[model samples]
Target: MKRILLRLINFGKKLPLVIKSIKKIYRYGGYTAINIASINYGEILKEKKVLITGGSTGIGLSIAKKSLQVGATVVITGRNDDKLKKAADEIKNPRLKTLKWDISQINQIEEGIKNTKLLLEGDIDILINNAGIVNSITFPNVTEEIWDKIYSINSKGLFFLTQTLCDQWMKEDKVQLKKIINISSQGGFVGATYPYRMTKWDISGLTQGLGIKLAPHGIIVNGVAPGIIATKMQPNYHAQEDNVFCSLNPLKRIAMPTEIAELVVFLMSDAANFIVGQTILCDGGYSIK
Candidate 1:
């Protein structure tokens, strides 16, 4: 039977693939091992300096962990000092540095960047604009104050932060591979609400504009729009047993914080060099529905 199976598989002389039973005993040698999704990127980001905003919790903290796993030097910033200290202690990485930064305040932008650079001991090689705020109010309830608050942090602050980094990178004599990853939302793609949705749309546009302009300078700009992720930043509507949020999407479950982090790690990799200016949505299928 073994001989017959081998002969049948090899019968196709020019077939692209020919596989015989692997568990069967082999006189020649052991079966050729195949590994899928086993590529080790642990050292892909070695010696890379990364700055992440709102790294105290939720999606931002997750990205910081993934960056550290990939052997990158990371500087995380947030407004809350206690949360920052807690996060730093939990991670316990010598390569990790925490700073206090609030993206909404444009006046402090230079100081914040300088602080991160000092902690990193060099210019930032990567920037993850993951700090964002969203309100649950609907279109009718949307007010100027609410709109201003959301846009100030989510849209305006994000753009200016990227702009500052871009300006500095453009001044360099030899531009290297720099990354700017903006965290957008599914609301940007679909017609959901008013202010929060409007700000996200700006993020999507900003990603494209920057990607095109920075292509010549080796700065790859991209965005990620995630749907209902189970995180402190966003409210959880249903309990684990109910799984209402998950059912809304085709995947039958809301995304975990770590799941979204995986996508972020991919965007930061060298393999994603060509995926510029595009804001990829990580929403399980909520938008399509």
Candidate 2:
């Protein structure tokens, strides 16, 4: 009897959501599966050169793949040489290139950017600062070593890399518009004491600042803050192949890396040129919940 009553209460609570969904379906002429036939491969990113950090796996890898599919020359950088090679093999595209770079090492920023430009034999038109680390350590449990480690890659490294690239672009007297897409996390939108979330806050702020500061120079800075994505960063979510469910999420499912990649591709293309330093939250309503 108790279990039955509990189920009834839960059903009652979800009734509004169900009704809302039904109304949306009916109003929008019902839902349909997104088939390949419906997708238009217009190659919106053609003739573009892109560079993605932490591109050997997960979200970065997905973004790199999509960018290449849209006819962009892509260069992916990772800390591991083996992983970079493996990603290159998986993509199997002549326009895809890989560089072994550790973004945390500030000393290597200039050299890495120079080498990447040399590999492309041209200036990078789009730079995606997607390389970041996360930890759950909070409040009293956080240590200085851990904080430094997270900030080095997530905040400091990103700042210098963007500055170096902008300086180079300015010196070259390039007339084409440049784009920088920093990958932050949905955790940034909340009040959290963890180092990872704190670093993400920094990313969100930097995106706005750089977006305004660099606009006069034909550079647009923006960011994507994804929530509960199924990636190695979220081990529990990534392990399940068929399971996309997430009870905590309002949508009842975590986002896939491909979904975030699509948003990134749009931001990189000319379609989003007018969009300034705003970090779009691709959290599937998680932040609001």
Candidate 3:
């Protein structure tokens, strides 16, 4: 029966030719043939080596989990060792590695990347800079220290991380369609009542500029600007008797971390090769209103 099945499979190879001849007789030859050829060249999303910052919880954790589910090797970093250990155990994937590092410390980034690279066994194919901080104080109440912390983590850290990765990619001559997905905020695109918005705006600028600078080297830089995500960060605002932030969006609800994660995965995948220098708004249309 196995031999018979093999013979049948061999005969199936001629089926396309027969169909093409029939199409030719019907005066629609090339269309069907082109469609069949295109099918043969269909692309698949294979496993990648990915590094995500701030992956102990929230959107970062969500992205790490989804990357592992899609057969990628994931390396995650956070400032808290306990949270990193707990998250690693919870993820339960042998391909996932966790590191503890605070991105705000530029001096630590080199060591962080080296450690992450060792776990990945090479340069990362995708880098997701999801580490960020926020404060709820009004603009007038914002202090120099608050601005410095936010910018250091959200903008400066992300920029330097991408710089280090790109340098490594160039050194290794592995700059073919590499991706850098920066996690920004809806506040970057609209007015917000936090000093953190300034950092996110800088992220938007860096993403666009990096997209241009790296495009020649086959690297794509893009961002995901999420709005009102239902994460632990939301409680920092302290403005609501209830979850009033949920209703502030046009969607009338806050997004789950996984929703934003899916978008990050897509942007990092082959599906988004043509999508470069863009900040995808994954806020359930919240920015529109």
Candidate 4:
């Protein structure tokens, strides 16, 4: 009888914790249903034309695939012709085309756009500035070359490309509701610790500035800041079948490239026109911590 009473007391002590767990489950579980509703499987992006930078692999590749699936003609560009060919072959869709262009070469932006137009067969309706490089070197070890290398692609290249495209789109007056979706990093939102994070911060700030400046021009600009994702870039977690080992993340698992692609697709869709100048952080609640 004494043992039974002791057990009852222990259960009572844990009741509050149990209740909190249930509440957390209910909140996140409800988000799944809401997310399902947000996904418009009715071909919301049908007949649109999209251009994705660094589309040879990872998040860019996933976005290209998803855009194609939603009835959009897509042009994916990369610096490597071999990888571009491989990505094209992997997709095997007539509406999908590949271009070889190095975005870091700002001088060749026009030439690259010309070639991209040739493959796209017309001007692109949406531009995805997803091409970027990372330097994991920390502050003490960081060099000027490392900082410039990262910025040349992630910030400078993206800015110039958007400017080039916007110049053309603004003059056309025929195509309405153009969109630019920049792929930033969740690290951009927090204090920076490296060159990569600093570049991302620039991207996030540029996204907001462009959103305001370009709203009157009929172009909507937005961004997606992703946390640690399971990709080749994150070599440690890339090959794991179940990547739930992240201690800093609230969700306890890294996101897949496809997950980021889904959000990109949503941002590109007509349904998200009202959302501008905002970089949505899909970081599994990592920034909150």
Best by lDDT: 2
Top candidate when judged by TM-score against the true structure? 2
lDDT of 1 by residue, 1-289 (tens): 9999888777766353333342221322233221214235768788889999998988899889988998999999888999999999999999999998898899889888999999999999999999988888887888889889998999888888888878988888754799999999988898867888888889999899988989889899998999877677655532222232244666555666676778888889897998989999988787888
Candidate 2 displacement at residue 2 in angstroms: 39
Greater-TM-score candidate between 2 and 3 = 2
Q: State the local distance difference test value for candidate 3.
A: 0.79
TM-scores, one per candidate: 0.83, 0.86, 0.80, 0.85
Winner of 2 and 3 under lDDT: 2
As for candidate 4, its clashing pairs are: none
Q: Which of candidates 2 and 4 reaches a greater lDDT?
A: 2
**Model 2: which ten-residue window has the lowest total lDDT?**
30-39
Candidate 3, residue 114: the lDDT equals 89
Q: What is candidate 2's lDDT per residue for 1-289, written digit by digit as tens?
A: 9999999999999999888777655543443222112124489889898999999999999999889888899999999999999998999999999999999999999999989988888889999999998998899999999999999999999999999889988777777898999999888888979889999999999999998999998999999999988789898778543445566657666777888898898899898899999999998688899
Clashes of 1: 2
lDDT of each: 0.82, 0.88, 0.79, 0.86
Give residue 268's lDDT in candidate 4 (0 to 100). 96
